[model samples]
Target: MARIIGGLTTSHVPSIGKAIAQKEQESPYWKPFFDAFKPAHEWLAREKPDVAVVIYNDHGLNNFLDKMPTFAIGAAAEYHNADEGWGIPVLKPFRGHPKLSWHIIESLVADEFDITMCQEVLVDHAFTLPMALMYPGNIDWPVATVPVMLNSVQHPLPTARRCYKLGQAIGRAIDSFPEDIKVVLLGTGGLSHQLDGKRAGFINKPFDLWCMDKMRNDPEALARLSNHEIVEKAGSQGVELMTWIAMRAAMTGRVKELHATYHVPISNTGGAVMLFENNPQPHAIAAE
Candidate 1:
């Protein structure tokens, strides 16, 4: 059966990609931020997991406002990067695990999640930036991926409870697969920062830190957070934290946080990277 070795969460700020392209990691402004992911890269290099279940939101790249599914899964054999209106240099196509994706899709539907399955997708910064941070300098990513898209950009987004439940279903699906696969889950986006209006440059360090501590000690406590509170405290884009909740919920028992770093004003966003390993023992809730 497939096993979830761990989970990771990071801010997918587009400016971070720009910093990478400009080779500014050592720069004073970006040094602290880039240095934070060093341990994460080391971990990935050592573990070398076979697959990654990436949970991220689309940033108006492939899916437009005209039609958007709250939850979409990519079942494709490969996915390419998108320009996202700025002509960012496209990376090589990312390989996908169609077999496992299909397995997950079928399982999610059976569990009543009603996820949309995509055969092809042009991933945006939300997907690529985190991969670049996690696996720097690799032309091709080391592991196959299953791209899971959630709607953080749109209102009426999935409730924290719903996101957690969906993740629980995904965890079950991965475990039930017959293959002996080692998997890592990732949730990308959010610390804090408003992107529009007069309050565009907002940053709330205290709130972001509170979220990290709470997520580390008791993720169940986060399920009660309302969207309005998230927006007010974290920022408009902070809704993206829902992805982190999903990543946390997919883990077994309480998670053990391995490494975490938080930096402010990364392109008007509060940036953070958190790495966590799932406890091997099953939680009591799992038996229910």
Candidate 2:
């Protein structure tokens, strides 16, 4: 059966894309954040997962405020990157695993989660930047991908608990697939930072660190938090952390923290990169 090999998390701030385009990774302001990915790169080299299920939020690129699904999955043969007006150069399309995507979508629906199925989807920076960070300079990505997007941009968003459950469902789905493939989960976006409103440019390091710790040691507590509480503590945009929570849930096995690093003020956001290994085992869900 297919199994999860590991999981990854990172900040997908638009400026990070621009930094790569400008070759500014080693620059003073970006060096620390860029350096964090080295260990992740090494881990990727060692494991070489066959597919990546990227969990991210669309920033008005594919889904807009007027109409957005609470959750969406890409089932296309190829996923493309577009000019989202962030001045980040467009990237070549990433190959997709249509078979796996369809299996996941069917499983999710059977598991009773409403899901948007997209045969053709445009991947924004949230999806692309994280891929670039992991597989730097590989214009042609090495592994097939499945984009799992959450609606963090709109209100009435899925609660932390709901997102965690969604991840659990995804994990179960992948585990049942007949293919003997290795999968990696990528949860992109947020450590903490708010843009717009009076609290624009707001970031809470203490809360960010606490969330990261809980992600490794006590994700159940983190999932218990309400959307209002997360926004209040993490800032409005900080709700992006839901993607990370979902990724963690998908591990569904013995999880070990391989490496993690956090840096602040990356394009007015807290930037973080984390890698975790998922050793196969019996499926288990944390108790509420």
The candidate that achieves the highest TM-score relative to the unseen native structure: 2
What are the TM-scores, per candidate, against the unseen true structure? 0.95, 0.97
- List the global CA lDDT of all models: 0.87, 0.92
**lDDT (Cα, tens digit) per residue for candidate 2, span 134-244:** 999855688999999999987998999999999999999998888989999999999898997999999999999999998889888878999999999999999999999
Q: Could you tell me which 10 consecutive residues in candidate 2 have the lowest summed lDDT?
A: 279-288
Best by lDDT: 2
Model 2 residue runs over 4 Å out of place are 282-288
CA displacement after TM-score superposition, residue 118 of candidate 2 (Å): 0.6
